[model samples]
Target chain A: MAFRLIHASDLHLGRRFANIPQPPDGNIRGRLMEARHASISRIAKVAHDRNAKHILLAGDTFDTATPSDSVVRQALTAMGENADIHWWLLPGNHDNLKDAEPLWETITRDAPANVHALADASAVELAPKIFLFPCPVAFRSSGRDLTANLMDIPATKGALRIGLAHGGVVDLPTAVLTFRPTETVAPGSIILRLATGTDVSKSAIAHIIAAAPNRIGSSMDGAVSA
Target chain B: MTLEGPGAPPTVEEVETGAFLWINTELPLLPNTDCARALEAVLPDEGRRDILIRVRATGWASLQQQADLRQAAARLGPDFAHFDFDTNMLGTTYDDADLDDIDKAGALRLAANRLKEGTESETLSAEERAVSAGALARLYAYVKEAAE
Candidate 1:
């Protein structure tokens, strides 16, 4: 049973607003964030309109370690618009602060059911064939990779196993685009995580992780059969 | 990783990562604890495990989120780039700037050849990377450093 997900990251809302004040499209906060949010809204609308089951936010929805109140409100409003969909924001390292940034807590407080912000690694059975795990950077860890932190992610028998996260791909430093394939499952299992190769520095992320395969980044940097 | 305070003379190791953090001997460090706190503030605490926190070369955090790991860090240097902290399976060819060439390149070629041999294999194209990437990168890096 193959379903669809929105694998978006680095929103950095209210962060620096890169390279510009306004876009040719007349949107504010840099073309990137606006473009992403626009796409997210579109995805939400699509999910709502199509009744999609899941909406995965890999990480960095907010720009700062401490996102501003309005920024939090804006995120909530945008997500709230998609009342029907199961909106989940796996706290990226940037957004996952020592304390729950007002931005996220606000959402949790406002919409308990609609918004699920898992700030750490958790195995939640979203569907019958899919056992999804999200690794959120809820706190500070030194000298360790968070993806490989858990025990046996990418379940043994499942049609789809996904990991939503907000970190770059590991090991291969030369290639910034992380679509080199990874190992979230055992040696020969057809499992997949919905990330664009996990590297944030490259462009193939959207095309590789989000498009077609519907893959997102997993902390595990191994190869999966899928 | 060396522990440092804010606005203190960074250790020789810290200087290596090329943080561009100025070394001011005159002001001196406020204190090691203070420095640690300040440096701690620089990195996001969201995902603590994957952030490779080291002190030797200017206080910095290198996060490995598994997929697209280090993408943002490489994109906007010194910017507040958000990266996931994954400790799971490691890519066969990733080298820190600090390692030497012979060691680094040696690792790469060995891994690549190992993959090519298809003897004791694991992960994606270990053969492809083991041939040289992570290792040679370190070697090339050393040569460049030596030339400098």
Candidate 2:
């Protein structure tokens, strides 16, 4: 038998449309707010229609870490109405662990029996053999990767492991350069530093030096030749 | 209920009711001594029941709770703005600054100041520093939100 689950994220409940310009005649802001709440029922209906018992909300369920009590209660109540569908909530950068401690605590204390808040990095069994490894965000902007340890987590044999995480993929290349102080440099002397632990080849360094020859000293040419 | 002195234990009647008391074990007290007498003496009126105890919690878990409370107080509304602090450790008043009076930017500045002071202090343990760093990152997020 195959497991079915609905993947959704960034519901952003209680989000005030402060930036959007309000129309003089219509209540667009109110309509947007109502729409956010209405999405829950729509998603639940979709889950019910598709026979997906599990609804995995990746992250950012709330607009802010400290959403109003009414917003939190209303969302939980909406999710609670659909008892058959299980809602798995993960804290994203917006509602991280450090900033949204009370929010999670409130949900844990008052959420319906079907809702599960994945606040810890643990493997939860969604079905008989399907497991979900959730990487809940601790800080709003953790410089380090949150899912670095997903591969090391132990799981059952032949189990279908699914990793759920949220964050921007940083593709910037970084390199650490160390200066080799072999000779005493003068005021106008160019210092050659070697890039360590990076994929930048020696030819790249030579190309960079060749691009700017006036700034780079003649000693680097001899060093590169050696 | 009758009381002997400031450091005396609670009577049976008081204990039968929901009289909550917390005593620091590091002080000069006997084993298993309740601090109900001290707590009762400081009660301003009959309506107040909650007593804020300021203990020097050095463990990582305790620091994390403190950090969480501070963050919640800043992000949440006025309900969570009040917090207790140890004057000896923080060199401040018995209570934390009233975050309700200040705006969001002011609250963010206060959190930043705390993170800076914690980082500069050499006495903080590794766990304490880690918690402070997490708090600092959240502070950055708060600032970013304000800017947006």
Candidate 3:
């Protein structure tokens, strides 16, 4: 049986959705702001329901590198509450490795046992035969493919190799317009873009993984569910 | 095509071929009231009309704005045939598809198909071809940006 995992990223917590007009008396506004946390809780519920032992977050867990104390505390509390699900948090462009030291420190200090920050760009086993290679973003806009070294990751026979990352997959412009490049690629791993405000449909993700029990590739693996 | 007052007589300017009414503007999106008024101004009050509104602009649209516009469109009923922001705005072009539904592999394949048609088709203008190509690229970027 394959190791069940839920991949998600670009949480962008504490983001002041400024364009969305804040209602008077701040009731709806509060709910709108708290929606991000609600989303996290929803993700946790997805993990619990799907029997996903691991929820791999590619990056940008927080909207800002140094989020407010309350935001940080709230996020940490949520992680603490969902202690059973393994959370693999990777540093992304918004939460760069070098810049967000204090925040990372706060996370490591208060985070539960299940939470793991994939700060280093190396291979680590999620299960006996399931290996995860995370290429965390060191800088905000490093003009280099973070997953360039993913192919070099030593292959373990019969092992499920999954790469967790953040940023864009296709970097070059294709006659359209100048597509902004970011460091969010893990070559061998199936790259799933989790943009801001996208409700990470747990059922869909689970279905995709369940369908491709052997390996999830860069293809229409979710067509059955789609 | 200017956005005149509500009671202003309908005056449509043809940008491309066919029965399309192109309203060239600099603003990203029309205000809710303005949008409704514009709709009323363009569409004939009685009978069926294949009203195509193409809002051409170097405009900006937020995710919320798009949602609001969509809501406005829904409320306006099926009076208009097709109402979309100009493809120039990423919000207008690649915003319809719930990219999460299709995998990167499938999207790429479909994009390839569209691109092939876009490049090979002789009847399509340079602008149409460019828009088609841009749509795919933007789609790829968006899907990858927020894939699960």
True contacts kept of each: 0.00, 0.00, 0.00
Question: Of the candidates numbered 2 and 3, which has the greater DockQ value?
Answer: 3
DockQ of each: 0.01, 0.01, 0.02
Worst 10-residue lDDT window for candidate 2 chain A reads: A206-215
Question: Candidate 1, residues A83-180: lDDT per residue as tens digits?
Answer: 66777777765667565566566666775467777754667766665556787776644345555533354336423445555555445443322222
Expressed as tens digits, the lDDT of each residue in B1-148 for candidate 1 is 1102211211211001111111111111221224333334455444332122222223222111111223333342233222222322323233343233223467654543443344224554755545444444334444444655
Clashing pairs in 3: A166-A184, A192-B147, A193-B144, A193-B146, A193-B147, A194-B146, A194-B147, A195-B146
Winner by lDDT between candidate 3 and candidate 1: 3
- Candidate RMSDs in Å, in order, are 22.4, 28.8, 22.2
Which candidate number would show the highest lDDT if scored against the true structure? 3
Q: Which candidate is the best by DockQ?
A: 3
lDDT of 2 by residue, A1-226 (tens): 5456665566678878565345476464565567668778877876787677987776778879999999999999999998999999989888999999999999889999999999998778777756777889899988886655654454344455556665432331221121111112211111211111122233211101110000112222111110
**Which residue window of length 10 is worst by lDDT in model 1 chain A?**
A211-220
Residues B1-148 of candidate 3 have per-residue lDDT tens digits of 1112111221222111112122222333432234434444544454322332344333434333344444555565345433344435533333334332334347565664566477446899978877765565555445444653
Residues A27-56, candidate 3: write the lDDT tens digits. 433443465566567777777876778877
**lDDT by residue (tens digit), candidate 2, B9-124:** 21211011111121221111122223233222332332222221222322222222333334543432121111132212321111123222123357556776687567556899
Q: Give the range of the ten consecutive residues with the poorest summed lDDT in model 3 chain A.
A: A206-215
